[model samples]
Target: EVKGDGRAEDAYLLATPYNRRVAERLAGAELRLDEPPPPAAATALPNIFALYEENIGAITPLIADELKDAEERYPPQWIEAAFREAVSLNKRSWRYIHSILRRWEAEGPDYEEAGRDPEADWLERRYARGKRGAGRLR
Candidate 1:
């Protein structure tokens, strides 16, 4: 449900087996979307929490290399330094940089969870087609 302040929450999400699992995962993520993202995820397997945190507003800046050989390379500090250099040079695009960061950060889950169970993406994947091309489930 959308909260009074306009932030969205699951409301009564733990109702079904699948929803319960999703809710459990969201809960376990310890997400703090109200602040900036950490340099890395908390757990050894980063991005589970990192990506979730960015879903709201938290973000960590980085300069990611374009995927070559079909492989993505996210250099943790390079983006920061690049942006820092741009700012140091008085480049007036830091805001644009952040906007790009937010957009890319939002895609983190898709990158992190490629080829995993689609059911895990139910809540946000509203209107997604079912196996039989049924109507939206979430």
Candidate 2:
């Protein structure tokens, strides 16, 4: 049993009955009292776009499920407003996603289309370009 910050030197003495039980359990499990365990493995670096995509995918299904449930409880206009808010928030959340895509397009395979403006994703491009002003949406 270990105490006082669980250092190796502290393992020499068992301090309490609980400690004794822990030590006995450890012995029963056949864990060696030799050296400290190996350090945990390093975590992978995060890809912001991949994270954004994963979050978007997770939230979409959840929102869909919630909408199905919520429609019965709320008025049509209230539900519509809630749905609009959800959609607006989700659409706005893609700023980081578009930034990552733009960065990848700049550095990765598609260099030529790095900041190309297409009609479909113009909102993202506009937001990325810092076109949104104070209280514009409100």
Which candidate number has the best TM-score? 2
Candidate with the greatest lDDT versus the true structure: 2
- Judged by whole-model lDDT over C-alpha atoms, candidate 2 comes out at 0.46
Give each model a TM-score: 0.18, 0.29
lDDT tens readout by residue for model 2, 1-138 = 332333333355458889777777654343345659999987744332233344555446655554345445434433333233334446434434344344444565232355743333656655665665533442
**Which 10-residue window in model 2 sums to the lowest lDDT?**
77-86
Residue-level lDDT tens digits of model 1 in 21-130: 77666664544445666587555333322322333234334322221211234444434433433344344353443543455556542323447443444434544775
**Candidate 2 Cα misplacement greater than 4 A, ranges:** 1-9, 12-20, 27-33, 44-58, 61-92, 108-138
Reference-based lDDT, residue 51, model 2 = 39
